[model samples]
Target: MEKLQAAQLKKVLKPIHLWAIAVGLVISGEYFGWNFGWAVSGTIGFLIATLVITLMYITFIFSYTELTTSIPHAGGAFAYAYRAMGPFGGLIAGYATLVDFLFATPAIGFALGSYLHFLYPQIAVIPAALVFNVAFILLNISGVKESATFSVFITLLAVGELLLFMGIVGPHFKLDNFMTSPMPFGWAGVFAALPFAVWFYLAIEGVAMVAEEVKDPKRNIPRGYISSLATLIFLALGVMILTGGITDWRKLSAIDYPLPEAISIVLGKSSALTQIFASIGLFGLIASFHGTILAGSRQVYAMARSGYLPGKLAQVNTRFKTPHWALVFGGLISFAALFTGTTSQIIILSVLGAIVMYMMSMISLFILRVKEPRMERPFTAPFYPVFPAIALLISSICLVAIVYYNVQISLIFFAGLAIVTLIFVILGKHKVQILIHTD
Candidate 1:
């Protein structure tokens, strides 16, 4: 009775909600963050990087969907890895995922504020970011159904805005402007740009974090993942290519508000249309902001429920049936992160965490195939070994390249991983029985 009475999430999500969550979680990359790739790789080099990363996501989402449908848990990669590789594997995946979404939250928050500042110069950036973070945290605590509904509405607005942006910016594109210094540092820059490319679809896997809440997840998860990825691939490539050709591209490469700034260059900064478009741009950031908080809290809730963290963190709100405490805890971490670094630095850390988690997830899928061949899978990955192998290979190469190019960031990531591992081991967490119910 006690176990049954414990707070649980309501299964109120449909395919549309999942699609909204999936696309909304990653749409911000189309808005910004990815332009940083141009700074390192130039237009042509970053395009190559983006294409390669796009392939990885295509293979990864298809391969990842099987694990998601088979093990429909809110822990996402953590649950998959834990089930495949045991407690230590679970901890590593959980920690990587926490780093991915938690860090991503503040990065998106920064963009939200930056967009607001771009709209109203006197509003200030950091304070606006802090407020957006707090607002979304509270919104997530309300209820999953209500949150998903809001996600659908906001996601639609964001998607429409991107479409409109493309339409407005397309005519102004100059092929010559885009081709200048197309490969400034040769092929090495493509490798350096991988993290920014990954940003284009970083958290699409976050849909897995809400698998438990999906209605008929076996059928809907694959649909949502496939559709959302298709949409993002179109939007990312179109936005990047279009935005690049409008100006020096170099000028837009380093800024947080690149898309709007690009628009201002085309439409005149003082144009009312430019101002309205900039205001609309906030929807994309808000969508991802909400999605990350929703996914981040679930990862925390799943870990806490399994005794990897304090049990209190798993407590769901009685009336809302949401992981209220987990939401609050994750929000606090994101707030700390807000002061940590620039949007580019935060994006690098988040992408690193995401890549590590992706590698773990692929390994888990392969292991599960061998370990539980008879386990019922409502959705099996197409092309099996080949798809997953490609994803792993590309991800491994990207990981190596990122570390080689950004030695300091790599060290920070590894050091953080090491510290967390040491603490988990010291706490004897590996020996603790972890029971995360997939159903």
Candidate 2:
């Protein structure tokens, strides 16, 4: 038997397996955070705006599809930069990618804990959720195959929950609920919802990071990304519309877990079915958080190995052959997030990371096209300059919108990332490069 080269690992991931991973990414974070956004922004105009936002995500998916197939390596955004722009660009991209995972892992971990509290109202949320995060972390440390398998199971349950919500709660859709403005902020309400809506759509690009692990990545990666986005778009539409319609939008906005509250209203409060529904809902949260941790850690490991991040993170488990160091780093960050913040704060930070990461990754697509036009592209984005250009514009606009609406918070977050960059430079740590032997 021929030993598999790192690049040849793509042959292992079939399109459906890749698609499952994508679905896992899309559903997990938004399951809970969308309510907070809906509450801050009103219902009427927010829904329309979110629909438009989904289109932007679609454009991003297409652009990433092109880039991932062209490079088809584990580094993801970092790899794209490493190949085209050189070490410094690769370092920045890797840093952004690492931060993306760092914040996202903990945000989801904390959300898992918060959602678990819904099921066991008596238990302390942090401890209960910490147990869940630790288990998934261990699973990830064990192997990628295990992580992907678990993601598939989680994705199924997540989809089932979405369908259940639609089936059980769809009938309650009332014209009176949606026709009137539910928030006092009016136009500002829709604008306010942008960040949260963006949060729900955060993980679509995650699949690209794992392109190395998938089989036939050329065909599978694009299929996986497109399918996952399609599923999430449908789910987002269902949840936003059904939740908006079933309960009074004002009431839905008021609760911390609006989807559950909305379901409780439709299923009747304090019923046996409500208990069962809460369990399933919490399961969805766990699934989402688990998927985030798994994907984020791999990206960190990939970046580190490529010399864009600390080489220490590149060490693979001799026994498990997984990226144990990166997994531990991710778990620690997530565990810390549980202590300092509300679920909303974590979700917002995760969204902030995603937005910034997307902007750089999108720009990377254009940069690569210009710099390495002849690189063997197993799959090409349908409209090269057009699709990527649209994605770039929309991501930039969203970043601006994020800054305009939440300047203080956004500024603080970006400042932190910048500071980290400077520290790496000043310490003379990042100047060291790792030579990955890829043939």
By TM-score, the best candidate is 1
lDDT of 2 by residue, 1-439 (tens): 1212221222355676677777886676557777777667677667756876787788888877877887776667777765666666676667666666667666666666656676677877678768977888898788777777877887888889889888988888987877666655777777777777777787768787677677667777877887788888888888888777875677766444666777788877688888787778776666667777877887877866655457788787877777788888888888887788776676666777777667777877777778877877777777777877787787777677677877777776879778877877887755555443333
After aligning candidate 2 to the native by TM-score, how far in Å is the CA of 432 from where it should be?
Answer: 5.1
After superposition, candidate 1 runs with Cα above 4 Å error: 1-6
Candidate 2 accuracy as lDDT: 0.72
Model 1 TM-score is: 0.98
Per lDDT, the best of the predicted structures is 1
lDDT (0-100) at residue 288 of candidate 1?
Answer: 97
lDDT of 1 by residue, 296-315 (tens): 99999888887777889889
Error of 1 at 390 (Å): 0.5
